[model samples]
Target: MTAHVAESTITVELDGQVRVVRRTTDVPVRNVKANKPREVSDVV
Candidate 1:
């Protein structure tokens, strides 16, 4: 069996201060692969 891994990094800045955030998480995968059509709804 084989497994896949993914990672990402994000940075945010506000006013004159800067902040860095790092995180790693496993992505959820679906056993069955299928494409569903999307519908658009009006929003008020």
Candidate 2:
């Protein structure tokens, strides 16, 4: 499954003008599950 999350942006003022130093973008997130370990063998 995939999920879209919104990110925040940062603004800064330099010289005498206000500008967006960092921009916001849509980030894709996914759910993950770890695999189960295999059972140990009695005979080695």
Candidate 3:
């Protein structure tokens, strides 16, 4: 449970002067499971 995005900056003026940019990114979510605990053996 995590979510955050509060950092931005963008200015453009091509063929003349200023051009500043800042785009952010952070993604890390990995729960690689190979049957951690999934037991189902009830055939009745």
Candidates in order have lDDT scores of: 0.51, 0.50, 0.50
Range of the 10 consecutive residues with the lowest summed lDDT in candidate 2: 1-10
Cα deviation of 5, candidate 3, in Å: 20
What are the root-mean-square deviations of the candidates from the true structure over C-alphas? 11.4, 13.5, 14.5
Candidate 1 off by > 4 Å: 1-7, 26-44
True-vs-predicted CA distance for residue 16, candidate 1, Å: 1.3
For residues 1-44, what per-residue lDDT tens digits would candidate 1 score against the true structure? 22232255445556756565554555544554446888889999
Per-prediction TM-score, please?
A: 0.32, 0.28, 0.19
Score candidate 1 by TM-score against the native.
0.32
Please, what are the lDDT tens digits per residue for candidate 2 over residues 1-44?
22223355445555767665444555533434546899998996
Q: Candidate 2: list runs displaced more than 4 Å.
A: 1-7, 21-44
Error of 3 at 4 (Å): 26
Q: Weakest 10 consecutive residues, lDDT, candidate 3?
A: 1-10
The deviation in Å at residue 13 for candidate 3 is 6.0
